[model samples]
Target: MKVAIIHDWLVSYGGAEKVLEEQLALFPQADIYTLLHKLGSQSPLIESKQIRTSGLQRLPIGDHRKLIALMPYAAEQFDLTSYDLVLSNTFAIVHGVISTPDQLHMAYVNRTMRYAWDTYHQDLAAFGVGGGIKRLAASLGYHYLRLWDLAAFQRPDLVLANSPFSAQRLQKYYHREAQILFAPVDTEQFAPAETRDDYYVTVGRLVPLKGIDLMVKAFTTSGRRLIVIGDGPQLDELRAMAGPNIEFTGKLSSPQVAEILSRARGYLAMAEEDFGIANVEALASGTPVIAWGQGGVRHTVQHGKNGWLFAKRSSESLNAAVEQFERLDWLSPQLIAQSAQQFSGAAYRASLRQQINSALQRREQEN
Candidate 1:
């Protein structure tokens, strides 16, 4: 069957891109379509695919978010008329792609676009649109974007969510129910170490929204060893704020990240996650997570069993969790690693196939 994979963009390798990569593994010959793509920013496997980008790819813009106005137009321009199956792997605009009645357009929606929805106020503040014309224009832009996003969100024949939290978001925003399919985790690649090191580990884009700054401040003040992995725009700022106890290892390969996760005493996460795949990976490495007690991390972390949770998005909260964390006995490495199998790549493929077949069968019966 002719297959097409639609993605939001390829500016960088992120959770959404990671899902797209897994999809590519399932359908190696599937043609890829995206709003924009920057070469060498993704894995070698994805870089080898036939990636078709929109007209916006020529803009030479560093941030993909800058093309927000042109996004829906670009998304609708994708010519997928010939494909039998169209899979939209998105956290952003790719769900806006047009589809035919005969074709199956399935979307793996992570969340509705933040700027158009949940983060609208935060985005307005970040852009410094205090009042008058700028705020009015920004508000109208997001308002229009919301209309387009909701219409785009409803285009897919079958909607699948990465986590229950994501499904809840879909219900809240689009008033649509979605089947929950946990994102694939590479459990096999990240195995438990024979022994753990004394340092704590945290991995993710070094962005402010990721709460890397919170982790940095907590460790800096306490003088506890922290190994910070991953790189992004906030790298320099984080580096500047980091104390002698903090170590930044900008962007490492999966194996290197796995090795670090496997040996670390615990993993630190401050961001509000959709599914918290990195935390799952830490569990696969037998490393307990000390994260903000919100979002999907609440689903994975069983307090006193695997790790501890903090109440707020502050350094004080993380330190409080850490204090309690030190008071408890160490969690079992073997059991923690074993618990992560539910999110393995193999299981993910099986569930995805089942959902596709069931959705197609239901569609046929309705016809």
Candidate 2:
């Protein structure tokens, strides 16, 4: 079968990119299509593939990260009829691709568009598109994108949601049902450490939405030490504002992150994540997590078992949770490592292949 994979962009490697890699492994002959492709700036897995891009590639903005802003307009360009099977790993625009009856379009969604509406207005406002005008533009953009996002749901023969929270959102926002498949976690690469070091660890982009600020505040106020991994727009200002107990370790190699996760006393996740890959990584490292009870963290972290979930998404709630962590016995390394196996790469691949096969069989029967 001629399989075609679609993704929003190839600017940076993250959880979505990891899902794309797994799809490629399942269908080695697949062709990849995207709205934008940054030649040397993707995961090694993506860089190794032959990728095709949309007309947006012609724009100067395509060479830089700013092209993400053009995605609402960029999505209208895809035509998927040429492929026999279409698998879209979409966090944004690739879902807008049009498909034929003969072609099966399966979408693996990370989350609904975060920047276009209710989620990240403050981040969008920073672009200098002020007040009423920004709100008006964003409103119109959300209307158009919502139509586009819902339309993709119709094209897809099946949808795979990365988390239960995402599955619920797909039903709520798009009014579409989806199968739940947690994103893969490479347990082999992130093995449990023999002994943990004293500091706490947190990983992910340094963005306002990520709520790293909450973790920094909670850890600092409670006199706990923390090492933060990853970087973003909020990095500099956050570093300046953070107390001495918190250390910001910009972006690091995967091995470096694994090493840090291995030795940490516990992982601190403050974001309202769609599904947290780092949370699993911490569990694989035999480190329990103290995470805010929101979004996918509810699905991934089992409170007081594998990790503790903060009842609220605030510094006080997180601080109180950390205090509670101090009271409980650190979970056995063997049990923590065992919990990580639930999200292993092998399990993800098997479940995805099974779903794809089922979708294909149903499509054939319909024909």
Which candidate number has the best lDDT? 1
Off by over 4 Å in 1: none
Question: Per-residue lDDT of 28-58 in model 1, one digit per residue for the tens?
Answer: 8999998888999899999998889999988
Give the alpha-carbon lDDT of every model. Answer: 0.88, 0.82
RMSD of 2: 2.1
lDDT of 2 by residue, 1-367 (tens): 8889998888877778877877888888889988888788777778988998888888866355456556756666676678888888888877767777777888898877766544656656655566697678766766776676677666677888999999888888778899999999888888777777789999988877778888877777887899999988898888877889889889899899999998888998887788988899889888898888888988878888889987788989988888898899866977888888988888999998889889889877877
| Backbone clashes, candidate 1 | 0
Question: Against the true structure, whose TM-score is highest?
Answer: 1
TM-score of 2: 0.93
Clashing pairs in 1: none
Steric clash count of candidate 2 = 0
Query: What are the models' TM-scores?
Result: 0.97, 0.93
